[model samples]
Target: MEIRHFRYFLAVAKHRNFSRAAAQLGIAPPTLTRQIQDMESDLGTRLFLRLQREVSLTDAGRALQAEAELTVRQFEAAQLNAQRAGRGETGHIELGYVASAVFSGVLQKQVSSFRLRYPDIGFTISENLMPVLPGLIEEGRLDVGYIRSPMHLPEALSTISLLVEGFALALPGSSWLCRLKEINAAHLQNEIFILPEQISGTLQVAAQGGYAPTLGPQPGGLVAVVALVSLGQGVAVVPESMVDHIKLPNVVYRRIQDCQPSSFLSLVYRRFEKAPAVARFIEHVKDFSERPTL
Candidate 1:
């Protein structure tokens, strides 16, 4: 009839005596007897054969015993899982990111730390363009995103700046500029610049050179932009961290002597996040950022 009824039946079945079962259940023998009688009436079957000293299970009681044990175990397991989810100990997070986030190592460091703290929380990570990450988070398709800043964001999303670094020039290995001991903005005045999703760094470099850059095709990701440079299609200005992580054939990274434009790797999430797992991750990011050292 009810979960408690199943539990009472199980205890009585285990001990084979109503008095002992009642003692184990912290209830009087008469109350336990009445509850078992009520269960038998509801089921319309006699579950036990009562003798002068002890009780023995009927055919129906044996049939119900296994099912009752399974039900009680499953019910208790469900309650435990619910409590863990409420505490942000077990759930899944949908995470999106740009290529630079991985290049900077901020994503790996922060995620690894969070995993160590909440091992039961799972993650589904994906890489997306910078422009779409905010939209994904806003639309509830993604729980959080790692992206580069200096771009427009939706009103419903908020970002936490995680790492700040300058830009570097990605050039064809055979370019004459690579031969220069120190390349300045003036030397890149007439070069065609392959643009990545975030163009602010390239624009900043051109603005400092006192001339408009010869803008080229805008690619989707950093790897594609660097690949174009490897083929001698054009040069690119990318996050300084890329110099260390993105090593493609025929593409050389050079520091610009004249201008130092900053790029930010940030974590973006919904302003009002409802999922406890996602909220816990955002809090972990905030805590990781405030630490004196990573």
Candidate 2:
């Protein structure tokens, strides 16, 4: 009827001696006897042949033992599985990110540290940008994200400022901008800038500075942006880390000399949605944030 019954039944079945089973279980012999009797009564069968000094399983007792062993094993497995999730030992976290996030380092570093701290908590990463996230986060499809800041965050969600990524020009090594220790909007006054249809990295910074930047070529995503810059189509204003991935054969990265503005990025999480696994994963991330060793 219950897991305890199977445990008792197994102990009794193993010993084939009531007194010995009681001794092994650390329960009084009479208590053990009563429990076995109750189990037999509930099952509508006698589990053992009771002799003054000997016991042996009946046909029904062996049948019950096999099924009872499985039930006990299942309970134990379920219990351990739940504990694993609570301790961040097993389970998964779903995360979303926009491209410029790689440069921010905040989310990336936190994730690396969290993985080391809770290796059993598997990770599912998705590349979901800002424009389409209102439905994702609200519908509980996305657990957490690194997204553009200064937008209207969804209601019942939380955000924490993590990094400030500013615009830096990437140009051909022979381009004049590379001659300066730094470059800025003024430096590009007469130069063409390659822009992405999803020019998230530079657009956010440019908007805060003034007007949208005039475009020379339109690309999509960071890779496209880098490819355009490498082709000498036009210089691109991109996050610093984009260069890390797209080391061009003839391109140079220069800091914006007259930094009109910068873009802010933050880690966003659903508010008040508590799951044991999610909480543990975030704690690992928060601990990493406090001490950024990654």
Candidate 3:
């Protein structure tokens, strides 16, 4: 008839006395009797045999008892899970990122800190191109993204700048420029530039050098661009953090003396995020960014 009826039946079954069950349930004995009677009437079967001193379960009552107990426990568990999800204590988040975010270590630090605080929250992490990350978040395919800054994003998406880093030149170790005590933008005027996902750093270097860069292969990720430079295909301008993280053979990193172009590693997500776990992650990143040590 109702969940309360099942509860009343359980209490009575446990005590084998209406007076004791009513006391445990904090209801009048007559009310508990009527509730049990309602359940029997709804099911078209007598669930208990009432004796002068105590009550005993019928064959139908024994079967119903097991099912009712399971149903009540499942219902209570469902309610608990829903409350935890609403509080951002447990849920799954789909995260996307570019290679530079991992190279900078900002992604790992923030994720590790958040995981320590909310261990029940799960993650599905993926690596994606810079331009594709924002679109994935906007399309609801991804909950959050870590990407480089100075790029266009969909109107529905927003970003928080996490790390600001300068660019470095990845050149062939045997190249003649490596012999120079200090290299500057002016010296790379005629050199071919291997392009990564973002070309702003290279363009900035060329602008300062007073020459239009000879743009070379449009290879995609940071590692691939560095791989091309290792083979002497062309030099690349990449985030300075890559100097420590990427150690491809035959590729050497040099700072451009005359120009320092900055690249930002940012966290991107929907402007109006609905998932509590994703929103909590965004807040955690914001807190991490504002710390003085960062």
What is the C-alpha lDDT profile of model 2 across 92-148, one tens digit per residue?
788888877775566677788778877778778888756666458667897787776
Question: How high is each candidate's TM-score?
Answer: 0.93, 0.79, 0.94
lDDT of 3 by residue, 175-229 (tens): 9999999999999998999999989999999999999999999788998999999
Off by over 4 Å in 1: none
**Model 3 has how many clashing residue pairs?**
0
Candidate 1, residue 177: lDDT: 94
Error of 3 at 282 (Å): 1.6
Candidate 3 or 1, higher TM-score: 3
User: In model 3, where is the ten-residue run with the lowest total lDDT?
Assistant: 1-10
Query: lDDT at 175 for candidate 1?
Result: 97
**Predicted structure 1, TM vs. truth:** 0.93
- Lowest summed lDDT across 10 adjacent residues in model 1 is found at 285-294
